[model samples]
Target: MSTLDALQAALAEEHATLWTYGVLGARTSQSASPALYDAVTAAYRRHRARRDQLRLLVRDAGGEPVAAAVAYELDGALVRPPQVQRAAVGLEAAGVETLLALVARSSGEVRDWALTEATWSAVWQLELGGAAQTWPGAPELD
Candidate 1:
């Protein structure tokens, strides 16, 4: 995939992550985890910001941003407490993998550079993601 292609893929991943978070947040009891709720909200905002950046880049290249899916596959059949945490981990892992792939598949100097930067950002994001999802309710709102 080219840089533009990688960007689009990253955009899609963002969309997917956004969707998954929405579902997970909704499934979780807001009252039960105020902190988690706040964190999730913040994560969404950040995702939206990054998404806009990606969209602008795509648009500047005369391409439209990929539309988000109306629904996600629920990331497999994980639904219980531990299952939910495991699911979150799985989603974040997938996002990291895609981002890394984008970096590897990228072409062009500027685009490659952007991909590299995005890859590093994702590495950091995944670390946080790992902690948040490591335990069923570790960073849960308390």
Candidate 2:
């Protein structure tokens, strides 16, 4: 796919991630699990920033930014902290994969930006209780 297409896909993932984080944050209690709540809040802000960045990137690349869906379908139940952590890991993993695709399909500043984003997402996976993988984005290698 083209670089613009890859970027749009990554932006779409960020949009969904932001929404899912909101759900996770609502379920997580600051008093009961302060660390988790803080992590969720930080992640939400980070993804929102990424979404905004992607929109600008798309515009700079001469493409119209893709609009986010009204809501995204989540995988499984996210009632407990463990479940929420797992869901967060999954979201980061997905982001890493999407960013990797963007990295491969782009060059120069866009590729560099995607690599940085992918690195962050990979680290987040481990922080969220995911086992470290040799290739964080490439599940086929793990």
Candidate 3:
């Protein structure tokens, strides 16, 4: 795929991730889990920043960015701590996939940026109770 396509995919993932984190934050807040709440809040901010970056990248490449969906279909209700953690893991894993695709199709500064985002997603996946994979982003290789 082209760089613009990869960037659009990443932006779509960011949009979904932002929505997932919103649900996570709400559930964590309701559970009174201060630590989880903080983590979710931080993740939400990171995804938002990444989303904005992806939009800029698309625009710089002379392409219009894709708009976010009105709503995303989550796996299930994230009403408890364990569920919230699981949702986080899934979100981060999905992010890793998206960023890895972006990295493969991008170059120079864009590739570097995608790599950084993928690394962050991998770290977040581990933090959210995912096992450390031999290849964090390229799970198909593993």
Candidate 4:
């Protein structure tokens, strides 16, 4: 896909991710545990920053950014803290894969910046769980 088109797709993934995090955060209960709750909150904040960046970038590209829905269709019924982290980890893994695909077509600064984002965010994710591959598209074309 074209860089702008790729960016739009990435933005859409971010929209879903942002929405998922919101529900996941709110759903975290007293039983969800403090550690998982804190981690989930931090994850959402990071994702939100990236999501907003893409939103503005969409404006630069003369396209409207996708609106994040109030909620996403989650895979299963809500569970406890450990399960919440598992869900959060899965979401980030999927998002990393999508972002990796989007960044594949970009070059120079955009490519480097995209890789940096993916790498760092993946690192954040790994902090909560284990190491997971973010970039199936690497060694990136750009």
**Per-residue lDDT of model 3, residues 2-78, tens digit only:** 99999988998898889889878877873577767777788889899999999999999889999999999989777
Model 3 steric clash pairs: none
Candidate 1, residues 1-142, lDDT tens digits: the string is 6667877888898898778877766765568756555655666666667678778877766778999988877756544444555555555556556656665665565456555545544444444445433422123423
Instruction: Please name the candidate that would achieve the greatest lDDT relative to the true structure.
Output: 2
Give all candidate RMSDs, comma-separated. Answer: 7.3, 0.8, 1.3, 3.5
Model 2 gets an lDDT of 0.91
By lDDT rank, best first, the candidates go 2, 3, 4, 1
Return the number of clashes found in candidate 2.
0
lDDT of each: 0.63, 0.91, 0.88, 0.75
Off by over 4 Å in 1: 77-81, 105-142
TM-score for each candidate, following the candidate numbering: 0.68, 0.97, 0.94, 0.83
What's the lDDT for candidate 4?
A: 0.75
Residue 102 CA displacement from its true place in model 1, Å: 2.7
Model 3 CA RMSD to the hidden true structure, in angstroms: 1.3
Model 1: ten consecutive residues of lowest lDDT: 133-142
| Candidate 3 global CA lDDT score | 0.88
TM-score of 2: 0.97
User: In candidate 2, residue 125 scores what lDDT?
Assistant: 80
